[model samples]
Target: MQDSAAGAATMKALRRRRGLSLAGTARALTNVAAELRLPALPAVASVQRSVARWEAARPTRPDDRYQLLLGHLYARTPAGSIAIGPGSDFAELLTALHLLGEGERRTAELRTAVLRAATDQGAGMLSLLSPALQAQLAAALADPARTTDETVAGLAAAVADVNGQVGTLPMVRLQLLLAPAVDAARRLLAAPVPSAPLQESLREAAVAAYTVAARLAFETRDDEASRAAYTAATREAAQLGRPWRQAGVHMSHALTTMYATHDLAAARVLADRAVRAAQRGESILVRARAHALQAEMLARAGQARQVDTALRLAWYDMEANHAGDPAVTSFSAGHLRGFEGVCELHVGDPATAHDRFAHSAAALAAPRELVQRAIVTVDQALARIRMGAPQDAVELLHQSVDAAAATGGRVPALRLRDARQALRPWRQETWVMDLDDHLLDGLGA
Candidate 1:
């Protein structure tokens, strides 16, 4: 059963933030449970059944609060329609804000009902609108008078919904949703707000848009756009006094610089900045990641022992902070392990690198991000190459290159070039000769 109403609200807000479906939320809970190493786990099938029941709108047992929270969190929309008029009480704004703050956990039925009511002025019991009526409704929402704090917050949640859907929708549909929200956010922020809470809300909206824009830029391999977007997010986060968000932007910049351009010096500077911000904020995971990334940059620059020392220091720091889960921040134990593997490969410790790579690959198995997976493979191949198996390295390189192409990322391509170069001495060997020609051809070398 679920906890108190406040607990429900908390779960709902978090679920909405994650943008998961009921089934998806349930699955995530399972993953999080395993990640946290919790015992007394529910079977996947049982969770699925519970989700199905919730989706069907059947009344669930009260003790199932966690399940209900998961259901609500996974809900596609809010549960009720809320409207604020010209003469509406300001308290309504508080109510609307409260709902938005619920994060992401709402039952699907509740969300569906809410969206229907909010978007459709007269849903079911209200008027089933004609095309003209629907247009009128939209026009009414567009009316300048309707842009109250409550309405604006509702719109912000709508934007979050779109952004969340962006991961699953076709690009065109995602753009259709995101563009309007971005425009709306810009307009809202431009308007006068009476309070700090209002400003913070608008700032968060800007940050969210910037984050999405950065992701889109990276997806298209537009480094300039990526950097610009990160800058935008950083500015907003700074304004909101959100140090963790600032750290996130810096880390992202470091990643793009390091992997996209192979600019070790620049990467190191950005990573160092990120580390300092994370430390200042007492963000253990982010600091650990910054340390690990700094180590990676050093290794790439041929500082093996220094890389090892940095990793050791970061690992110890992580232990001291009792960094519970990488999921808590952009940095994770898994990410550190991957970074360690990459450094090991560079420092001529193939065996140790292989083990770390294996740990990274296994740890990141459930939520697959293509660019990250490619990095792991490239690291693994580097380890293999260092172990004197150019053939195996070439095969892993092939996989990495293919995956990177799908992401339009250049990092894996750069790694492939280095891997092939390592095999240059063995090019005359029958096992490596054809592979070399194929690799060069693949890279247009």
Candidate 2:
């Protein structure tokens, strides 16, 4: 008789034959577990290593829980029929009978029940809003009210506030603040307003609102919402005939493609389009920001020489323009340096990245933008890890985590996860374990 290792090999072969990468398989398992209401799902890296061990003919076999999940995900027969060449693991045989008997059917019913419950809860919440609030919302959606000069001025101040809050407020909080404003602005744009000057102001305000809305969505990982907001912003900017506003929107869209979607080719095209649009605009600030965005994207693509050239152009443009519109451009010397550091990190220069992050950290410390501060701290931590200083990396990561907790930002949480993954090799170390435990507790993971 053949060994049980043959069964493990078959499972590995099946996964490969289905054209699923290790990450894809892990995601499938996770989704199935969630649907089945499993108590816990395995990590992606854990699943990857388990697959490798299985293929290597290790003693370990897929556990009962994993067996059920994999079977459902791959549409395989019940566990009882799963053959391992000859003899099965005692644990596998013991659980197989129970799993095949009634567990499978019960799990399917539980998944359906969970879906129905979720749908019902969502409907109930929507129906819970006050009647007056619902009527006002309906009116805003159906027919927009006309805008006045005072309203436009108020909107401009709100845009400025939104701009200032970018690296300070949590993304969810920002989204909550911007959503109603964006809706109101959209309605005002649709309503008939007699004053041409007021109409222009309203359009500008709408563009600003839409741009902020897009940024909020992007930061929160809502790609479709971000894209829709960007589209709306671009349309408003075009109607306002403001090349600078259009350029700003294009730059933001480029960032969304680059960071959010990870489409390098599409990001490059949008970045170039932003530069061209900025060049056509009268505002030097627009040109400066466009160049800065181009530099950041080029750095991510590992185009080192082009990155320096783009950064240089950005600096030149900023120097040529003394004044910048706060609502239009957030470009500054310190912010540019932060981007330069990010570029250096991507270009594989950890030392330079560390130095640049240090500078940015110091510069931002005075104003104390919690989100930006956390980002720079995490970047520094990553650089330190790359430079083979795990201890130093741990310290910086702690700072970043604290900053993130203070700001209630998801970006910091994501960076912390990356740091944790990078430190996996040192998992057995007491300090590393403590740090991991701390992170899990704090992040509510």
Candidate 3:
């Protein structure tokens, strides 16, 4: 293995046998890190370079973490392992070796058990008359130990970090982060824990993970997965008995219903539920978010009076709430303004919508909010189109499309498509045709 050519050939062969591209292998390593609760996961680029180094046999042996991941990836068991060592923790080594040995069967059984536990809330009695059968049952029912408060808090922070990165990262990369987090959260929920506080914290973390998953799914134009994730979040939030969590879940569901399904009535209902849930909580941030969602739904429904009332309520709540916990609710003046701008557009106030969008875009200066700013810019462009400024709309639309394409945001891509259709009256105009051509070139349409 120390021979450069032989090591390079072996590494390349292993990767090929797994049928994974360099990027795919990097993503798989990320997922393995998340699932195993590793302290650190390498960046995709780092993993890509490492693969290249291995294929080149540059006298580099990856650290323990990468070695374990590689072993797992290649299905190396205890008998066939190349990485397990005396310094490795015995329990972890055994677990990894066992999983590698029975990967498919164990994965299927664990998935089935998790689903059953989630659906039933209790497992059925198993026949354990024999010692061998008892051992098998014990192994099947084993769960990870309860995590510490600090660990739980760290997991929550990790989810928030991913949420903040959504605007900056490409959709595929975000999904890679989110999928494993969601899976780990669900697995934690299925495991038995001793403390109520631990359970509550886990539920909260799970709710956040599920909400982020739902948001990502919505952005990627996966309506069914979005709804399912929202439903799962709602369920987890309900288990925690936290009105703020419930309100957040409902608000997320309302957004999906409004944007993805175009079910305005259902959106309104969900928004109302969110508002009611928030009213039962002390978190003014949650209450304000609920009101803002209500405003958007009402605006879409053409209820101008109700929309204004909802916005006013949200404003009042925000004024009263001087502080907020992002882990619980991420409502801010800028976010409210963006929502208001969207509502204003729907309520036939293109000028106000444009102004609001401009303000919101200026306020949203965070690097992670780039995609969001681009989205608002696109909406502002739509307002311009409504105000009979097709040329300005075309320019803004081009900027928005470029920004969205950079991040692979499906929602903005869809909006750009709609904007193109809206320019049908001026389709034959030179600028309009040029915009269309640019769009086609960018989108490979």
TM-score of each: 0.59, 0.64, 0.66
Q: Write model 3 residue lDDT over 386-428, tens digit each, in one string.
A: 9889899998888887788777777677778888888999989
Ranking of candidates on lDDT, top first: 3, 2, 1
What is the model-wide C-alpha lDDT for candidate 3? 0.70
Query: What is model 2's C-alpha RMSD?
Result: 21.5
Residue 302, model 1: lDDT of 96
What is the C-alpha lDDT profile of model 2 across 412-445, one tens digit per residue? Answer: 7777888889898888988788787778767764
Which stretch of 10 consecutive residues in model 2 shows the poorest summed lDDT? Answer: 82-91
In order, how many clashes per candidate?
A: 26, 0, 0
Candidate with top lDDT is 3
Candidate lDDT scores, in order, read: 0.59, 0.68, 0.70
TM-score of 1: 0.59
Best by TM-score: 3
When summed lDDT is taken over every stretch of 10 residues in candidate 1, the lowest stretch is: 84-93
**Residue pairs of candidate 3 with colliding backbone atoms:** none
